[model samples]
Target: MRIGELGNETGVDIETIRHYEKIGLLSVPPREPNGYRNYETSHLERLAFIRHCRALDMPLADVKRLLDFITHPEVDCGEINRLIDAHLHNIRERLHSMQSLEKQLEVLRARCGDSHIVRDCGILSELVAASHKTGVKKD
Candidate 1:
């Protein structure tokens, strides 16, 4: 099938498929006489695996490592477990940081109290005060 057909089947963009091929994540398919890519079932399956990994927010390098493991069935999967654990740990840290940011935004949002005037906006006032405190000169 053509690249567009492959993308339609996988819900992936054509440019992204090309990017994956460029980065050696997705294998390049053979071209037909017309020079259009002739993707096979293997390409579809590999693309699907890559898409699933990306959906899980796995980094490309990690996805590549996972793909390498797929080609070697005899190896222990302990490395995969460790990789997933590390990703989970990173997610937890991000969640914690996001919660803290949410709290800060909540406090900042409270400063405005409701719709007033721009001059009476406590949020802007606090921001300006913060910039001054941090020695940030506004252009």
Candidate 2:
């Protein structure tokens, strides 16, 4: 099949398919007689794998590393374990930061629960005061 057929099958776009090829994530397929690319079964499988990894929010470089491990299945998988652990740690850190941000926003929101004109808005006053304290440059 061609690029479009492969994209439809994998739910990936044409440009992303081309980018994978360009970045060596997906193998380049042979061109047909009329210069159209002739993608085979392997291309379909590989593209699906890439799409799955991306859906998991795995980094492209980590996906490439995982691909390398595929070629040498007998090697120790300790690195893969470490990579996943690191990714999990980063996610936990972000979740913590987000929770903190939510708390701060909640406090700020409580300051102006009642409707007020722009001049009397507690939220706007707090924001402007905080910005000045942080030395935010006014353009």
Candidate 3:
């Protein structure tokens, strides 16, 4: 089928599909006499696998490693297990960071009791003070 048909069937954007092909993630399909790409069932299946991995927030490099494993069925799955574990660890760290950020925002929110003019805004004042002290404009 054509690139548009493949994208519709897979729910993947045409540019992304082209990018995957460029990056060697998806195999280049054979061209027809009219010069359009002729995607086969194998391409569809591989693209589906890539989409699944992306849905799980897997990095492209990790997806490539997983694809390598798929290509070689004889390899043990211990490495895959390690990769997932590491990703989980990274997610947990991000969760902790987000939680801390939430608490900071809550504190900042508490600075103002009610809406006021920009000149009299406690939150704005605190934010300016913070920026001056840290050299980073964060509130």
Candidate closest to the true structure, highest TM-score: 1
lDDT of each: 0.95, 0.93, 0.94
lDDT of 1 by residue, 9-111 (tens): 9999999999999999889999899898899999999999999999999999999999999999899999999999999999999999999999999999999
Give one digit per residue, the lDDT tens place, for model 3 in 57-101: 999999999999999999999999999999999889999999999
Rank by lDDT, highest first. 1, 3, 2
Error of 1 at 67 (Å): 0.7
For each candidate in turn, give its C-alpha RMSD to the true structure in angstroms: 2.1, 2.1, 3.1
Better of 1 and 3 by TM-score: 1
Residue 97 accuracy (lDDT) in model 3: 100
**lDDT value, residue 126 of candidate 1:** 93
Q: Output candidate 1 Cα RMSD.
A: 2.1
Q: Which TM-score value belongs to model 2?
A: 0.91
Q: How many residue pairs clash in each candidate at the backbone level?
A: 0, 0, 0
TM-score of 1: 0.93
Given candidate 1, what's the lDDT at residue 103? 99
